[model samples]
Target chain A: MEELLANPYVGPLVLTVAIILVFPLIVGYMVLAERKVLADLQVRLGPMRVGPYGVLQPLADALKLLLKEDIIPARADKWIFWLAPVLSVFTGLTALAVLPLSDRLYVADVNIGILFILAMSSIGALGLILGGWSANSKYSLMGSLRAAAQMVSYEVPLGFATVTAIMCAGTLSMQGVIDSQFERGVWGAFDNYGLMLIPTVLFIIAGTAETNRAPFDLPEAESELVAGFHTEYSGFRWSLFFLAEYAAIVVISALCVTLFFGGWLRPFPNVELLEIPFNTVFPAGLCLLIAFGCLKGVGKQVVPGFRFLMAAIAAAFLGAAGLFVLPLTNELVIGLFWFAFKLGVMVYLFIWYRGTFPRFRYDQLMDVGWKWLIPISMAGLVLNGAVQLLARG
Target chain B: MLIDQVLFYVLAVLILGSAVMTITRRNVVYSAVWLISTLVGVAGIFLLQGAEFLAGVQVIVYIGGIMVLFLFVIMLVPLEEEASQRRFSNQKWLALATGLAVLAMLAVIVVRGIGSLDHPGPAPPPGPASLTQNSEAVGRVLFTEYLLPFELASILLLVAIIGAIVMSKARRRQTES
Candidate 1:
């Protein structure tokens, strides 16, 4: 078993399978989180009926989607329509292969790691474009047209911003970027007298546009386009598109964290005095805090089932905190904890953007992508490049 | 060794088959999709050759950037009339002549290099260690050995982009006036 585990190919293969299986659950919970967060921002209780605070809402949603009748428009280009959602989901998940979750945990450490993600995103664009065009509906076609133009325009700034990170790291590999950050004893966002923040901000904006989240979600402007490209899609097919969107959201957030944040490294990684507390205690304490929140909610629940569920969740979080403190699991959990923590923060920012901002007008979206983002990102690139050169000299 | 050969042949077949389908499709959108498949197959071949950076650039620039533009153009055009019109059916002889010329050129190149197949040069040191350095090697050569040509290519692409914008702007002005 040890020999098998040591085989490089076997390890990555197992990791690949694990990511594929686990990511959907993560994405599902992310959807619930988005709803819950959006609800909180709107000052309301959201989906309290499904599970304790709608914890099982994603599972219920998944079952409903799975059991619903799949529909394809009669006039649609059947093959392309069928292929679109699969393409979206496939490219979204495939991009995960290059995402270095930690130094030790990743599927494949390809030399062109970031570029691979970029390429997958480009293909993911194809899924949207094709889905829109194939639907044979006017709205679908218009949505796709917007998607193609928007993605193409936003990608310019996104590429330039990524170039900024790549230049700082002097490598395209994701793991290499984090290692360089560690070596420099600063996150990419904090590098070069904080000039790197320009690209960091540009990346977040461009990434938001790239993923078609508000205020840049012109392609799927529900009020105008009636659900946009997936208008003709229903049931299982629509769910696939939803899955792909959330998967993309997660992937882009992970990319943002990996590029600007210190990735799996704890904040202030080189501060030896704080290392034990930050690495070991902080993670467990965070979980315990969440458990405490759950415990507080247990007394307020009117339903016995809801109260029991709340307590059970509190227990689960307590157990998780327990695992974090255990000697055997401490080191194993630390890296994943930091990575997920950073990732969660980024994901929350996305949800926050959605709740706060109104959608951009179509022309306004194009203006932002071209008139603002591209030039700013380009300038950021040149500035960071100059700073790096001078620092090296 | 066996897996490498198998992957190579599989990718080659996919590339060739998809290229054929790309031309044969009646629907322009279908043709565009097939072209993407062909590009992806080519990218797979590049990956199989251990040129990871080249493989990535192939997918990014070709399949991602170029092909999306192609699809956008194809969709913007009214294809129903074009589909009804005879394409290669009318230009069969001209097509055949051009195809033969290209085939002859390729054949000549292949024949010239055929001798090396039996005594092919040593493969690049194949392992994960060397594989991970593929992009570094590419970056070094591109920036140092072929820097001028690379810059020239970028300038040329810039010129094309500007020319396209100018031409489109000119047409829009004509329509407005």
Candidate 2:
């Protein structure tokens, strides 16, 4: 089993399946998370009846969507119409190929991982463009056009910001960038300056715009375009579009964790304490001990002969001792915990933004992408170059 | 030997099929998509030739950027179904004959070129860095040795931008006037 897990193809295939199965669940709960956060901010009670603190809301929403009737507009271009949502979902999934959730966990560690991500994301705008155009509705067409223009404009600044990070790290590989941060014991964006300063702030702003989050979601301004490009879509198709949107938010969050935060790197500088687990095979021993304890307990319950109950009690005590020794295990488990914590912070920020900000107007959105973001990203690139040069000198 | 031949034939068929579709498709948008497929096939050929950077750039610049602009233009055009179907009758046969003759001539030239390269020569040096470094290397070289040409390209882009704005704005003025 250990050898199987270590196989290259097996790991990616397993991770892919896991991501596919887990993402919808995450998205469902994220909806609840969003509502709860928003309700807290607005001083109102969120959903409570369905499940404890509205835990079952996402499942109910999924059921509703599953039961809804699918609709296709009469005048829609049928071929492109079918292709658009598929393309959106496919592009979102492809971006996951490079995302590293933990130190040794990733789908493919391509040398040009960053470029691969950018290229895949470039295809996503096509989904919006085709969705609107194929619908043959004036409103849908306008919304899609706005989406295309907004994405194109924002992508430049986003790419520039990414280039700034890449230049500073001197590598296009995501793992390489993360490892650089780990080596320094500081997040890449905060290595020189303090937190909430220049380039990091620029990255966050650009990332938000790139993902079409609040204050930048001009494409789907509900009041104006009636849910924008996917307005004509219904049921499963519309759900797919929502899935793509949420997935995109998740991708950007993961990227922020990998690029700006020390991905899977423990916050503390010294890792000597963390490495203590490597000295002993505690987990393996614990697993064997637990199995023996389980068998003894079962034997005690089924057969009341030879004082089995007392022997089982002793076995349980030994298993509990093994459990207590888990902290003395390896850096691998600690690294996984640190990675999850960083990703959680990034995910929390996405929810925070959704709850706090209002959507931007079309003109204001364009102005931010062009006037503000582009200039800042360009300046950030220059700053990164200067820093690198000075460091070398 | 059979596998190699099959691979070559398959790529050739795809290249030809997409090129034909690009020209023959009545819908401008569909034609643009067909053109993208043709570009993708060309990138595949580049990959076969060990020109990974060239293949990537072909996809990025032609398929991703330029074809996107083509799609935009096609979408912007107020082309009706009847107007799209109307063919120019003035030089239809003449144009077809000329096109076929040119194709035949190019095929002959290509065959002759291939025949002359029967003997394999020394291989080219390994590529400088991986495919990922292509853009960075090109940027460095262009900004240093080819600085003048790089500046010229920028100027050309500027002019095109100005020209596009002028053309679009001129139409508005004409409508108003």
Candidate 3:
């Protein structure tokens, strides 16, 4: 197993499959989760008819989108019109490649992971610009222009916020940042420098703007621009736009997890209890460890079948361990519990933003991005740098 | 070694293709985009060469700042069909000849350079020493060894900014008059 992990091709290949398969699934369900939450908030039931309590709503939506007719406007440039959604979806997915979900999980943990993510995000804006321009509609054109300006403005602060993490962690690798947070003894805003209260708040705000979530979702303000850059798109093509937006939300959320939330890290780093007795006596500890290794291996295969098998196996093991293994694997159980809890909180906040806030006016979006978020994030970066220097001194 | 090969091929294709597209594209906006691709490719080349600070500066200065200015200009320019056509004169033959000559020279230099190289040169020592040493050395040399040239570059940038402002103001006055 160690030998397999040590294999150069095997590690990266597995990471790539895990990223591609898992991220979109998370995004798809997140869409359903948001709908349900919003529906409940507005005193309505959301997709109750779809598989038991709407568990299958996302799948149903996916099938509906797949069967929908793809449309192209009469005046649109056919080539660019086709290319735009592809670009948007491609760039949106590209971010997942650099994001680290766990210590050993990332498609490609580049030395310049943050910069690569930022660059890929800017490419998504290019798709919006092209989509709007090719449509040849006034509303679409205005939406695209506003989106481009908004993204460009917010990107500055987003970059600054990212630089704060990079400076504090002293590494550009997403995994490294998470490891730093874990090594510091806590997760999220509770980590180093006596808690990252200010910086994390700044990062969350900047991240919201960067992903164009509500209160900053000027690009797709339905009341103003009638669906913004995709005003002329319909059916599967329109669904592609929604896919890109939701995927962006997931990517940014994962980034927030990595940068500030100690991604996939259990809450307390010093709490590992070595079970020498269980390993020698019951041997389930060793088997559980082997199961984990297998999950990592199978997860890398990038096939849906393997991924489902891996998840099911993990769940089965946890369920079967109720009698003898529960006492032995308490720390491991707790660790997994904390990890899931953290991810759930982050996911809830993403949906909460969608449900609560109204979309920003285009000018307000630009102003907050340029005037407030950017400066505050820059100040955070400076403060973080100074803190690091002082700590070293 | 595999990463190096991939980076080399990707950067080479990006730089060459985008450079060609920059001139070949008739639309001013497309040309600006091609220019951005060219600049981004150069940044990638810097990364391939293990120059991280240089790569960051390349993106920040060229892509983030300068390209925005270029895009603003392109957007403001009224590139009507007649104006676009008038901008290009009947100098295709001359341009092609010049381009071919430059390409031939570049090919010869590259071929000669490859032929002169030793296979699998000694690997440098790894870790932060190798990574930071070069950048720190360059910084020292830049600040002290080549301070005059560095100062001159800043002065040149200042002059360009002032000249741009003057040109725009003059144009505005002329339009008003």
**Model 3 lDDT tens row, A44-127:** 998765644565678888888889888788877787788778877887887777766544444666666666676666666666
Listed per model in order, the count of residue pairs whose N, CA or C atoms clash below 3 Å is 0, 2, 1
Candidate 2 chain A, run of 10 with poorest lDDT:
A275-284
Q: Residues B1-177, candidate 2: write the lDDT tens digits.
A: 364457667777999999999778777766766776688688778655545556656765675566656666666776576355665577999999999999999999998899768886655344222334544665678789999988999999999999999999999999999
Q: In candidate 3, residue A3 scores what lDDT?
A: 95
Residue A364, candidate 3: how far off, in angstroms?
2.5
Give the clashing residue pairs of candidate 1, or none.
Answer: none
DockQ each candidate and list the results: 0.60, 0.22, 0.17
User: Which one wins by DockQ: 1 or 2?
Assistant: 1
Candidate 2 runs further than 4 Å off: A1-7, A192-197, A268-330, B1-15, B39-64, B79-151, B165-177
Residue lDDT tens for model 2, A155-256: 777777777777767676778888877776668767655421466777777778767777677777788889888889988888888888887887877777
DockQ for candidate 2, please give it: 0.22
- Judge candidate 3 at residue B151 and give its lDDT: 100
Scoring only chain A, what TM-score does candidate 1 earn? Answer: 0.98
Q: Show pairs that collide, candidate 2.
A: A277-A329, A277-A330
Best by TM-score: 1
